[model samples]
Target chain A: MLNIGGLNQGVVIDHIKAGGAMKIYEYLNLEKQDCSVAIIKNAKSSKMGKKDIIKIEGPITVDLDMLGVLDPDLTLDIIEDGKITAKRNPRLPAQVTGIIRCKNPRCITSTEQELPHRFRLTNKEKGLYRCIYCEQAYKR
Target chain B: MKHVISPLDLSMEELDKVLSLAESILQDPEKYSECCHGKKLATLFYEPSTRTRLSFEAAMLNLGGSVLGFSSADSSSAAKGESVADTIRVVSSYADICAMRHPKEGAPYVASIHSGIPVINAGDGGHNHPTQTLTDLFTIKTLKGRLDHLTIGFCGDLKFGRTVHSLINAMVRYPGSRFILISPDELRIPTYLREEVLEAGNIPYQESKVLEDVMPKLDILYMTRVQKERFFNEEDYIRLKDSFILDAAKMQCAGKDMLVLHPLPRVNEIATEVDDDPRAVYFRQAQLGVYVRMALIMTLLGISAG
Candidate 1:
């Protein structure tokens, strides 16, 4: 079994749905950061059956609002002096801009390359999003 | 800075105000002829829509207001690669208000954000056409006499018809606006609308494959065209074709007072034989579009008839 070191002072993005760490890593642009990052995929979990975890070395600041859009069940644990300090469950945002592209063919964002693709949370319980331009549903 | 991007943009009160103003304008056109004399209306159409463009122009002219702006993207700087935001910002300074029709959905929304003047969504792709909705409501109020406690039967292509969806959304807010959706199985109203809108709102509705089955139950029969490609099988198309077309025979099933409407440039969804029926009001509906649009422009421009 391959092993990775625990974070001394950073964040442990826990309970990410299995196979979702890489997407979060890419979304956060972790490769561009100076700090070290370790991804644990298919980690044993009683609750999720299997979950992916991200342990970041050293303190890092990234807006977690977008992560809610990816996986609403995502949990964030802040590490300080090698001890867990705070935990957060980032929920879906009311409005998200430029994170997801509007794929509707008739959407203005499709032709207007400069327009920021904006979405509004029309149904929170269903985690449904609609394009501000076309009201087309966001498809995963 | 107000923009009418969707019918939902107007509150119930505001909608009543606009409809009331339209009724008044219809009752006495000469009294409100100069309501917008010093104002100007810009028709910024990114696509060619002669009917909607002329209706808007006619509305402004009816108000004694001058009209300007392009009828197509090729005639404007959009051909030179100018953005909607940029064009609207410039046009905003040139006109007091503007009605926009764009092939891309929400182009008017983009323009509205950068515009200094009120923007009316003439039509936006297959997304929204608020003025058409306003006109429908105005027609209902002026001719049928009320907006509530009525049965509206939507026929033909309910799936791709933007007007049907918008009118449903607008009417559902009223006290007893139920729907009798008539379309082929392939072109029924989308699930989200059927489940989320109608079912969720607890608005009573029934779906049927045949138009005549629901004709007698309707107070307003709204019709749209059905493309041939939408059928699942050729034989079913042959069998069910006449069921969707409103002919004199189908009109027989309708009530004597029931009104028939269509967003025109209509193909054969409505038989020309039925056009002479006293209840056939689609052409009059288009004419009311001008009055409704005039009222919309005035309401948005804050130019009261008083």
Candidate 2:
């Protein structure tokens, strides 16, 4: 029953898998920013055995599609004036650019550090993304 | 500019453009040496692929470009916990063009989206081997004098053989060509290939386990190793092992003009007796790889090697 008092307004990513809050924080780069964020871990849930919740103060831009990949089971709720204003369930992007690594060691992307890892969504339900360069598939 | 990611992305005209450029470079090597002057080509190989790396390096050196990149992932930044994206982002700054090899499927596809210059997939886990396909095409064009109406037999490991798959896909677009798949029961070509390439294209094909039985019918005998690693059981490897070997005895059954090609680093699959056979074209296949790559680099970089 960990609860942070309040926040001005922003997004509340709820129903995150337990202990995944820190990953979300790191992924979002919460510490380096000036905006305030409250992360609650090990919160009891009826659907999920245990979950984590994140409350962000201010309308921080987050790539929801990537969040879907990082934690597919997450529920994002935009809060305004202490009330849930909007709900979003963004699907994983059809093509991911500059995120995720190509696991193929033979692919040129594996060596070139300046290139962004790009993949096209080949199978959405399977979470499979194929590399445009190497045709390597990444499932998140 | 240096990397070749996919064959589908390259049109037929583009393929022809590359092939023609490669032809010119093959005809005149000294003229293209300064084409890549003061440029660097990096190859980051996460897998053990000596053939692809050597060809890439040879292509660059022949074009007056310097080559630098790791051949194994254990010696690279991947061991330092860096993602493939980060590595490419860094390397793109160092090299003008890059080639990569990885075990993970579609690794280069991911790299290409992020790559600043160009990313070439040397090979990904059983996914696609475009360069090898290009080399095979170039070899066929050079030796056979045409890309159409030839019957090619793919022997040995067809199940996980990327080169065989790519060649099959690329060749079907032409007229009068057919495939004779020779493999053990366990290493049969996948259904997707049958349904997608052969059936869809309505290309005639036959399946067999005996190489000698079908040798005379084939204009090109493309042999791939039935690798021991591909077998689940040791007994299976031992049992079907001798069936795929291309020795002098087997070559006797093949047509005199029937060229033998292999995407190689062969162990015992191709016997030493066959190497001296004038019909044996595996070494020539390897040599053609550089020319094909030269063609690919020139085409992708939007420059004619002329």
Candidate 3:
């Protein structure tokens, strides 16, 4: 049995798709954070079959919008005084700014270095996002 | 603070107002000659397009407004790596209104974000060219006498013709408007347009390769150039080039009142002989283009004629 230590006061991001923990970690800039982060990859689950999990031992504010684009299935739990405080299900933002880069070479955002890469959620069902300026569909 | 980044920027009612102003300008150019006496229009062209640039300058000149700004990126600070935001912020102080054309898609949109004055997108790469669409809408409403209830045929390169997509977008807003798209198999309208714009709007349409077959049914035959660069093979271009050409013979297949419209700089898609036809309104469309632009400038600047 693989055992992990419990968090005292922090966040437990659970139900992440298997192999997605590292991405969440990098996106959150966990390496720069002064908090302890534990990544559990490919953990067995009856619901998702295998999922990745991240436990942080300090206050952290994940960009819920970015998290939504990364993994909608993932659940977030906040702990305070060693007890679960709040649970969060990050939802996809209507307008996404400066997260995923628009890939169209003809897009103005491509040539302008300082322009924020902004996208609007066109289809929530398909998880479709389109560049606000160029109208180029954001492809995963 | 309004910016016309795309054709969809103007509502149908707003389109009517602009077109009405265009017709009035054409009726009596004197009434609106000095409407914008104190205003200035900045023509910011990031690419070389003498036609569009001259049209904008002419429009400003007609409105009694002085014009300024560079015609090419090399002449502008853009070549020196100045951002669109910074340029627009600076240009806003220099001019009351600005018409911009850029090779990059959505460049004007970026400018719109930073602009203190109204920003008109002249042409943005292969993206939005709202003014051209406005000009087209004006031509149709003036010549055809109505904005709706007509069968419009889009012939030639429907695939790469952003105008066709834009027109379809504009027309679908009107009632009882249907389309017949005539293009070669290799140059069909984009699938997203077919499904999203057409099907989503419940717009009735037909696709055909034979222009002759669709000509008689059309009230408006909108033609576009089929650039050789759009085709992958030389043989295909050679085979398809002559097929899409609008000649006197093809005009016989069309109705006497079937107005033909083409965004100009024609390269043999339209035979020179068809220029004599009263129905061939492309030159008139060009004239209307300037008038429409004058109206657009007036609308943007809020310069109503006294």
Which candidate number has the best TM-score?
A: 1
* Candidate 2 chain B worst ten-residue window by lDDT: B1-10
Quickly count the clashes in candidate 3.
Answer: 0
Q: What is the two-chain DockQ of model 1?
A: 0.84
A30-138: candidate 1 lDDT, tens digit per residue:
9998888999999999999999999888756778768877777889898898888999987789999977789899998888899988999998987788998899989
Error of 3 at A138 (Å): 0.7
Give the DockQ-based CAPRI class for model 1: high
Q: Taking the tens digit of each residue's C-alpha lDDT, what string does model 1 give over B1-306?
A: 578999899999999999999888988999888999989999998899999999999999999999999989999999999999999999988999999999999899998898999999999999999999998998888888899999999998999999999999999989989899999888899999888899999999998987877888999999999878878788878777778899999899999999999998888889999999999999999999999998889888888876
Per-residue error for B143 in candidate 1, Å, reads 1.7
**Could you list the iRMS of every candidate?**
0.6, 5.9, 0.5
Off by over 4 Å in 1: A1-5, A42-51, A80-88, B231-239
Looking at model 1, how many pairs of residues clash?
Answer: 0
Best by DockQ: 1
Tell me the deviation in Å of residue B8 in model 3: 1.6
